[model samples]
Target: ITPASMTIVFLSITIGTIMTMSSSNWLMAWIGLELNMLAILPIISKPKTTRASEATTKYFLTQAIASAMMLLSSTINVWQTGNWNILELKNKFSTTIMALSLMMKMGAAPIHFWLPEVLQGTTLQTALLITTWQKIAPVTLMYMISNNIQPTILVSAGILSMIIGGLGGINQTQLRKMMAYSSINNLGWTITIMAFSPNMALMNICTYIIMTTPIFLMMTNMST
Candidate 1:
């Protein structure tokens, strides 16, 4: 049941990613994000155990907050710029809002408190999906908007994620949580290079996935 539910969640997140990638409007992107969140809620709670329920609640609350922020940012952007086109972002305030929302969505630093806790509660395979496939959409969107995002904000978030991910992993007992932190650190590397070369960012993302897959598989095998 858990695996099946997770598969459905993965598919939903893929759909959300497609929506996000193809969306020209902010509202559409928000809808896609909401879809992703809603799909994953069940997966987070599938264990039918206390820890899973706690994690699901925490994830739900965190995602709800992020969704609210996304809505607020979109509303502000529309009000200030009188436009909803994702690529039409022009005002500094709107751009900043969009960036903040994306940062939160991608589990970037300072806004990344939910990731470890959530991963700690899930099965390893679910963690793999969250760390890998589920990340594709937001990161792709971030790469697309890299030119508009503030360099300082990206740098700060990237650095913080790297430091926190590395330091946080040192004491983690659960292997899944450790991998989640590793994913965060890798995301930091990807974001850091995004400012320098968009192509490099793409390369980093590809390489990270390729490298991380084997590690995740190994852990899954060992755990079982």
Candidate 2:
């Protein structure tokens, strides 16, 4: 992508994430997610290699599925509750599906298989974006609805993510893939804490970003 086009995509990504984070309704959040997904595609495939193409396709499919699930759950919620309010999720089935979909979007485990592969195929900078900036919207949404989600499900998923993330990274040689697992691990901790304290979860994410950004930048500078 050209500099101008890159600038535009980056802006779109930012706007999309902000839209999702700030939206009070599920429809707007879904639209923001779609925008975010679309904007990131070009960045993922910019290298134009076979691996990059594969990663782009994988990412698009995974995100599309998650977004579709989110939309379906939200629609179900609207059907049952007669409102589109984010804080008004009352249908049990819809709530579970929405929670799972948000987890999928953020690459929390069991559903986390796509992440390492996608990161490994992209440039380090793109991988950095995948692990960091791409997380905010979904995490924010999850936080918004934390009260509606079952604590048991949240705790189980969180613990499973932590286990998988830790165990999965041990044998990885690729730096991007390793970071992917690490992202999973850190997010797992965040999710676990979010079950009891959301503010702490938010602070954890901020801390993760601050600590992670420089490492990725340094690796990028060294072309490692």
Write down the TM-score of every candidate.
0.91, 0.98
Single out the weakest 10-residue window by summed lDDT for candidate 2.
148-157
Clashing pairs in 2: none
Off by over 4 Å in 1: 1-10
Cα lDDT of model 2 overall? 0.94
RMSD of each: 2.0, 0.8
Cα lDDT listed for each candidate:
0.80, 0.94
- Backbone clashes, each candidate: 0, 0
Write model 2 residue lDDT over 99-187, tens digit each, in one string: 99999999998799999999999999999999999999999999999999998888889999999999999999999999999999998
Give the C-alpha miss distance for residue 182 in model 2, angstroms: 0.3
Candidate 1: the clashing residue pairs are none
